[model samples]
Target: MTAVTAPEEVARIQGRVVRVLALGQVLGGVAFGATVSLGALLAADISGQESLSGFATASVTLGAALCAIPLARLAAARGRRTALTLGNLFALVGIAIVVTAAALRVFPLLLAGVVLIGAGNAGNLQSRFAATDLAAGERRGRDLGTVVWATTVGGVLGPLLLTPGEALGRLVGMPPLTGAYLFSIVAQAAALILYLVALRPDPLLLAQRISRDAAGGAAPPVDADRPLAARYAMFAVAASHVVMASVMAMTPVHLQHLAHAGHGGAAGANEAVTLLVGTTIALHVLGMYGLSPVFGWLADRWGRVAVVLLGQGVLACALLLATFGSDVQGIVIVALFLLGLGWSAATVAGAALLTESTPVDLRPRRQGIGDTLMTSSAAVGAVLAGVVLGQWGYGALALVALVLVALTTVLSPLARR
Candidate 1:
């Protein structure tokens, strides 16, 4: 094993690793943005039912949930490089399949492809953890936050590309909505290259080596195979995601409904609705990743559980706003932004805490499990959001979800110690 004992060398390598991972996030996140923005429209069109539209996003989250453990295991066995590459590979295949599914108008095939794309999402999610592989105690949250922030650029750009992607598709005789995913293909490919070439010294492997060295060359303990603090981190992370996903998965639909209602349900207003929804989602994506650094710094300066509690507070604010103002376009837009920001605060802090709570040897495995739980729970929420939105309305859905936010808020304080 490569000896990575020196603090300076580890920090230097960490800088490089973070840079690579950040850039990878920029590229990889595009796929998710493209899929999320277009996936719902495509699902409704393909299935001839609006209720199934949210399932499109749900599939992506489900895919990520499924890939979490396996990719974590790969990181445990080979390294982060291999696991990320495999993730990109799945995304690449998924992109092609989605386009094909679009051509055939096959909803199931489209879901299958979206699910594979989730593998890439899982990799992107895991990259935040990779940032901590060589992170110093104080700067762990900062380093992780930097990588998280990089996604803002790609995510915003991905949705913006919807117009041109469709143009490109029209020029090439491709299916209508499938063209935007072409950008996803290129972005993911570039990310795959970045990971394979730039992420040198495999941050996880290096951290493992350094941990062994610190422990006199003996493997670290698992602490009775229990990671209590990790459980709190997972709950915080999962809780934040569930609320975020439930609302976000349906935001576009809600906006579209408002647009149609205003225009008397005229089909001619589809373009206007698209523009509004796209802009709202773009701003929301910005909220998700834009202020990560500030939160990360705060988590380091303040306390992890404190930041988590603050996140719950923000989420509560968002849920209430979304509940009462569902019909108002401007209020919904602001609420979506707040929703993204709250998720960012909770997840960023929750992740840093997860890293701090576990032993080095047990980090990867436990993190994977945490992510699996996080994504899985969010997937369920996303699915339920669809049903609730279909049967009741957006306000009712948001009101119903307040219970989740309250639960997380009440329990997170107990883990402060």
Candidate 2:
């Protein structure tokens, strides 16, 4: 890459590129977000299995957890563009695996593919940070939010594709719903192309140059190689993501059970379940991404720690509300909405903080580690939620959420500046 440009020139060029990248983020997120929800649905439908759906979902997170930190280090050493391009490639491979598994009716292979897709997700999850790398400090959150909002189009549209995907799959003699994976492959490939075309010089390199300039062009101090807190923010940032992810994975499954058992063996149970899953996916995606800019902005202005605490507080209230109405779909929707919103707040803020807290040299490493922790913990949570639901039911799970909320109170002080 080239040396730093003047601030004004940097602003002009970087501003335009970041906007383009934001659009790319939205496109990628739409595909990825939809897949997360739809993959679980497809796994359940094709395998004629229920409990195993969570395992499929967990596989993706497990892959992500395994790969996130290493990828971050790679991006830090190489460039964000390189890392992202690699991610898209992984997604393409994962898609092919899923497609093959579906054709052959191989559940284990399908799960492996799901894990690979999750590995791609680990890369996709870092897009907001890529956006932040070029931002003019104050606008970080707003920029991040804009990209997230872009997902609204794809996130909603992905699930809506299910009916058509299934029909198409049947026409092709593949398992019903396997067609969705085909769409994902196309979307993810397009995403890879978008990054290749738009992310010139890469935002991470630009940021490194900018930081170098700000440090009087001297070798910048490595802030990232500090204490454990500076290096990880493990207990706080990772925990927030885990909680958010765990709950998201649990949501559709909960609704599915309710529809099956409580809806009086409804004739439209399958469709209803699909719709509920889609709606919840849409809502959760909206919640997580819709207000991302606001959170990014707040992280820059008020400090990331404050945003983390705010998110935790909102999450606590939302979980409490969920406990009151386990029987109502609307209640679950609202609670999940709040959960998504809370997650967005904490994640965006926490991510920004992690970046800010670390030295440039260490930023990527720490980011990867932090994200891996978050994803791994979320994977565990997903599996646990499924087991809990199988044994204790949704109502009992709500109590567990309440306990999680209580623990957040203890952690709230940790979020203070």
Candidate 3:
């Protein structure tokens, strides 16, 4: 008879494996965060059309929506390696298109390029799934959380690059902001290389194979038709993401209008706007990604539904705070901070919930559909934010956000139990 491995031995090996996967994910997160946070800003500079910025932003999210499901299916049918490699290739192609668009100064072509880049964003979203595959029952949250924290590092660096990127863009015969795209290319390429070299055996496949071997070749698939609570949890999680994305995307513009209206100050309008936008962006990012590990750990212990409800409540309060003090600088900062934190809670918890609620074969399908909804909804919200903010002013936008929060709050209790 074959010798049985000790539980401790198995755990040690798994830990090592999980670390490798997390490290790769962290690198990927940095690239993903850096590109997304600044894409709109860059688009504005290149196109010289402020309104088109939203379209550029939408293209990336739309690309994610359009391709996330297809990519998931590809992963399910082929394997993780093929899907990720394909995503990297698509990103590369997108970058090339973006570079060409910048050189040619074509607005529509630039939007098209961003769409291709967005397809890559879909792949990055699925990276969380790979991290989860290496984790044990409740530890899924913690693993996913670590990867998000990695994103904060890259995200912090992305905006700071604008100073130097502008100079580089001038040298390259493109606009000042175009240099950031070059950095994106380098960062994404590095991520692609790391994924190809380090992510071996494919965690999803490994998890499945291990379970099968452990079960003597007869283990049931993870999903096998989940319970009603699981389905509800999925929707709640998805809803949280929708709210977070929709609101967060419009914040920078909100800061601009508030500043222009003599709310922030008169002397340093531009600088003040930059600081507000950058600071809020940082906080929003921190809130959305920083506490992922803790929430992930909590999901493992407290139950996904409970965390999901708590997150929704937190987000509701954030919306209310933002609405009441839409014009105050300090208040807006606090509100955005809370908003980011709330998003982080819901996003991490929701992801864990989704993973737990569904089985292996169904993972790609469920995750793809759920994320597609989340990204697409956010895209719609972004486009709407542009129009609404222009028409009704920031106060009205805050009120709208309040309505969303209320809607989520009403559903929170129903979601929990």
Candidate 2 residue lDDT tens string, 234-330: 5566676767666677678788887788667879887777778777777877787777777777867887667877888888777776667777888
Q: For all the candidates, what are their Cα RMSDs to the real structure?
A: 2.1, 2.8, 3.5
- Write model 1 residue lDDT over 1-417, tens digit each, in one string: 558687777778999999999999999778778888888888888998888888888898899999999999999888899999999999999889999999999989999998998877887788999998789879999999999999999988888888778889889999977788888989999999989999898999888877767766433332233366678889989989989988998888888889988999777677767678778888889989999988999999997888888888888899899999998999999998999899999999999999988877898898999999988888888888889999999999889878988898878755755
RMSD of 1: 2.1
**Against the true structure, what is each candidate's TM-score?**
0.96, 0.90, 0.87
lDDT (tens digit, per residue) of candidate 3 on 29-58: 545543555566656667675555566667
**Candidate 2: which stretches are off by over 4 Å?**
42-49, 213-233, 415-417
- Candidate 2 has its poorest 10 consecutive residues by lDDT at 217-226
Query: Could you tell me which 10 consecutive residues in candidate 3 have the lowest summed lDDT?
Result: 1-10
What lDDT score goes with residue 27 in model 3?
Answer: 55
What lDDT does each candidate get? 0.87, 0.73, 0.68
Clashing pairs in 1: none
The parts of candidate 1 lying over 4 Å away from their true place are: 216-226
Deviation in angstroms for 127 in model 1?
Answer: 0.5
